[model samples]
Target: MEKKMTSGKLELVAAKKFAPYGEMYKVVDFLNKTLKDKQVIFGLTKDEKGQMTLSIYET
Candidate 1:
């Protein structure tokens, strides 16, 4: 699954081949690092219902 977070909303793209596992953390970490380096605002995580959520913020 791939996701971009914006304005409290998560835009996600999932590939059937990719299984959700420890990879999820990797994705989140990657996004966080990229956003920080680019000075962009974003967030990534699973919601209370265990659903993946990506949120982007105005920078």
Candidate 2:
């Protein structure tokens, strides 16, 4: 699943990936700073083990 958020002149995208903890943390941090706005979207997914993951994209 994916969640999207947008504001005037700003947009955010979030996605989830099945990756290592280090990679996931890097992605989350990047998105947090990259977006730097309340108008952010979050995308979530689950692995076969039922582990949920999140990713974010911003513009």
Candidate 3:
């Protein structure tokens, strides 16, 4: 059987990827440092101010 997050809790987490600087690398670093045996979900989206941002969640 496949496991799912449906029975677990998801928490919103944030990481920085400043403009004209490190982007994906920063996220990777964050994940390498913080991630353990849990699960993660991520995506790219624009903010209200029209800034492209990355969203990461722990489940």
Candidate 4:
């Protein structure tokens, strides 16, 4: 069985071909400053309302 994720925790997912979720260019720039990878990392997380949200970061 799969384990349940803790509240407020982030889970990483592959985002090789997809652009960042919001403001593609700006998100890339923000990530580039902290990470030096060509591929972007997508994160799955739950919001306060228990809705799933996707977040992006540079690997």
Clashes of each: 6, 3, 0, 0
How many collisions between residues are there in candidate 3? 0
TM-score of each: 0.41, 0.38, 0.39, 0.31
Cα-based lDDT at residue 8, candidate 1: 41
- Candidate 4 lDDT tens digits, 1-59: 12333334433333233322445555545665656565555445444654544455433
Q: Using TM-score as the measure, which candidate wins?
A: 1
User: Tens digits of per-residue lDDT for model 2 on 1-59?
Assistant: 56666666545455555654545556666766666776564545567875667755554
lDDT, residue 26, candidate 3: 69
Candidate 1 root-mean-square deviation in Å: 6.1
> How do all the candidates rank in terms of lDDT, highest first?
2, 3, 1, 4
For candidate 1, write residues 1-59 as lDDT tens digits: 44434434433333123223556667667777777765454455664666665545445
- The true-versus-predicted C-alpha distance at residue 55 of model 3, in Å, is 1.2
Please give the lDDT score for candidate 1.
Answer: 0.51
lDDT (CA) for every model shown? 0.51, 0.59, 0.56, 0.45
Model 1 residue 5 distance off true place after TM-score fit, in angstroms: 12
Clashing pairs in 3: none
Which is the winner by TM-score between candidate 2 and candidate 3? 3
RMSD of each: 6.1, 5.7, 8.5, 10.7
Per-residue lDDT over 1-59 for candidate 3, one digit per residue giving the tens place of the 0 to 100 score: 12233324766576433343237656656675666466776645555665565656677
